[model samples]
Target: MANAQLFKSMQQSQPLPAALARNAEGTPAYALTPRHQLAQYAATGCLNATFYASAEAQLATVLELCKAVEPSFIAQTAVYCRERGYMKDMPALLVAVLAGQGAAEFAPAFQRVINNGKMLRNFVQIMRSGAVGRKSLGSRPKKLVQAWLNSASEQALLAAAVGNSPSLADVVKMVHPKPKDAWRAAFFAWLIGREYIAADLPPVLAAFETYKLDPAQTIPDVPFQMLTALPLGAQDWAQIARQGGWQMVRMNLNTFARHGVYAIEGMPELIAARLRDPASIAQARVFPYQLMSAYMAAGENVPTVIRDALEQALETSLLNVPRIAGKVVVCPDVSGSMSSPVSGFRGSATSNVRCIDVAALVAAAMLRKNPDAMVLPFEHSVVTCRLDAHDSVMENAARLAAIGGGGTSCSAPLLRMNSKQELADLVIYVSDNESWIDAKRSGATATLGQWNVFKQRNPQARLVCIDISPHATTQAMEREDILNIGGFSDDVFKIIAAFAAGQLDPEHWVGEIAAIDIAAGC
Candidate 1:
């Protein structure tokens, strides 16, 4: 007979490399490269209080990571997060760090990342907070701010003036942008409370000033906040609702209903039509989870038609979720920490969307696209969640999110799969990546151990870990067969599809960031 040792399973699992550090959960985990850490935080960090990290701790970690990586990498990561990941706070923070470093890429990165007034304000606030390094908007950043102010259209500027405590008006005061024309000069003067000819103001501003003085005028097509203080009737509020953009409409459904917009003839149908418009949804870059947030936040007064429209828009937004060609397993982490808001706690400003909501949405969308996919909701163990292929994605997501709230064991599902000899072409995990329940002190993470066993049976299987929180460690090391990505944007689905088709290198998420053309004109 052949020697038993020689004939034994050649695929016996080997010990993994020693963990480089501990995760937020105080468990042994691999440390990400500086660039990878920066990318992870940039994509998912909101600079708020996460379950595992405080706002102060997150800020310090981000600054340290920025120092370790090349300034250019920071710039690229900022652009990648803002443009592709559709993140807001973290990208602005990265750009602020670049400004502090005085890198050559700062100007272009600022121009690209600070695309809107809110973002510009964020960058200015971060600079002035002295968190990154400087406490003042130095000459370069001030110049860019001035340029941004000069370049914005009159309507855009008016909309930008809605927020306060360093609002657009405050930014104008800081930058003292030189006016290019008489209208701008008059507008700047009016913005800062200096006297100016009202007629010289841009059309929208002129209309706004007139409307403010007399509530009888047709509500100006300015931001809704600008009109909220005016004494207006239901019809006036209806007109404002009619003029609101897609995002504005989605966010203020309850407000619109409260203001009697739905009571107006034909208003509900028109708004419903707008809500379901595919082109507008794509242009707005609306995430499915965002629509889910809107849907859940809508009050009883919100129109049924509008509620149906939100569901339709959610489906339209997820049109890019790929239908994989083979067996797929989606394991969503339903641990207790996932109950915290997706954007982290920021007092009253925290998002209503929870991390688990996004994970469940992703898993549900995948199941909808691939009707044969298996969904396993896990915390310390595989929690059974029954989902139907034909059920609405939102309903299925709610079901999956309702199950587990125990300690995280990222290895639980994989171990279950190994025991059952499950075959899968792709194993997807949507989690915070703070696994600790099954962590090892001197060997590979239990996740890696189980994955190795699963790989022995299916050599070509690929694992995709979609982290939805801001953290700097992972359960499994990145390799040719593994991908670690962050963020809740639907763009993630496209990236997953490309990776599953072998269109990306092992560098995966970081390679995508590294490939950004930072030198390209903004």
Candidate 2:
């Protein structure tokens, strides 16, 4: 096909932009349905918020999606507001909550929350909730409290908060200052508020107590306890692991890994136990990669025992993959361009995982679960994947990553199939969608032309293009049989199964939530 003819065919395909496409009613149509909004957020697999094109546009889409599940969304409102910098546009009560969560750099935004008279009652309400605070303020919790304490309205807010919930005494105690160069009042106040085991108090606290007892007291030299009390040591971590449930244990372990402290005693056994637990296995499936990635980022020696457990757990978890019975050819594009990081938000050490890795993971899952499937690692041409049922997801991912990273040719699979006179029930291409095919590369047949020829050769074959990145358009998406999907989720298999069964529409899955009302709040 000529470039002109290829362009014409793409126009007929009605290619939908992955994230911001709208419906006939002019409401936001998310590629995944509104119900999967949180999953979409989690699917980013990292916390860095710069993954999307613009924060404003992303938040707008999120807010619109929240309308589908308003109450649950309301509960997480504070988190999104702080995490995404949506503070300025939030309702006054939410803004006030953010003020308490505090980062000193957002002092200007805090001032706006403080000055809103109508929000005072809501502010007081949040203070009285006694909820464990979020990291909205970054490293400025003390500064936040001080700013509030300096206000003329401080007494009223504090009184109201303490009156409603006495638990805030600890925060208030920490926030207030005593006489110049003295912290006696604050120290005792904090001490009285909580019960502490004798060994748990760090060496610095004993020296502080001695100093208080006598002005002549020789204070022993000790490392100062920074920000959040003493740093969590091996003993503290063991106690934390013993105290919390599986989820809590996993979170604590991950936090430790993030801080470059991974030698905690009993962590390996604890992690293994969680992986094997029936209750923990479901959440384990999605999070083990993230946790392992964290450990890898820390440059810690990841024990083979831990790695094997995660792989086993993922296999156990994916056994629930809605079985799609068919001869399917899974092609993951391993072009060098696919090595680009999926998100702009990732910084340094932890961000090296690329789009090709994501595609390979997906393809591996499909190949491992479905016995009738074949995987091909493709660049400018197609080559067979040496994937066996025994190959782990990471192992297959490594195989794909090792393939030649040259130019992209989305039509490679189709060309291979047509030449070999092969047939499949379905053909899935996992790619970044920068095909940019010319006659020199594709040899007279562009991606669409190759697909058309493949269709004639195997009329029963279905074409599925799973765009792992958010590309604006993809070749062959305009056709009725060609189903285009976007985003990163294992749940995508369920969508594929449903589409194969003719029980769901791919365009509908890729488009906005049809059931959502654009004007319900209006």
Local lDDT at 216 for model 2:
51
Candidate 1, 1-522: lDDT as tens digits: 877665445426445666768888889887878888889888888889988889899899999998899988999999998888888888999999989999999998998999898898888988998998789999999999999998888877887787986788889989899988879888889888999987789888898888888877788899989777767778987888789999998998888888888889999999999999999999998878889999999999988998899998999999999999899999999999899999899998788889999999999999999999999999999998889999999899999888758999999999999889899999999999888899887877888888888998898999999998888889988889999998888878999999999999769989989989876868
Using all chains and alpha carbons, the TM-scores for the candidates as numbered come to: 0.97, 0.57
lDDT of each: 0.89, 0.52
- What's the C-alpha lDDT at position 422 in model 1? 90
Error of 2 at 310 (Å): 1.5
Q: Give the TM-score of candidate 2.
A: 0.57
Backbone clash pairs for candidate 1 read none
lDDT of 2 by residue, 1-522 (tens): 579868756764653333244322222222334534432432332323342244345444444544464332333333333222212223333443344434232344344344322233334344444421442333353464455544423223323232222233444454553322123333334345645443434345555455555535543332111112444545444444454445445435455455433466667666666655666766434433343343334334544555566666656655545557668888898887777665434445335557777687778778777867888788878866677767777687778776747877778888888898887888888886666332332222266667767766676677777775533345554445767665554456766777666666444343323332322221
Alpha-carbon runs more than 4 Å astray in model 1 = 1-13
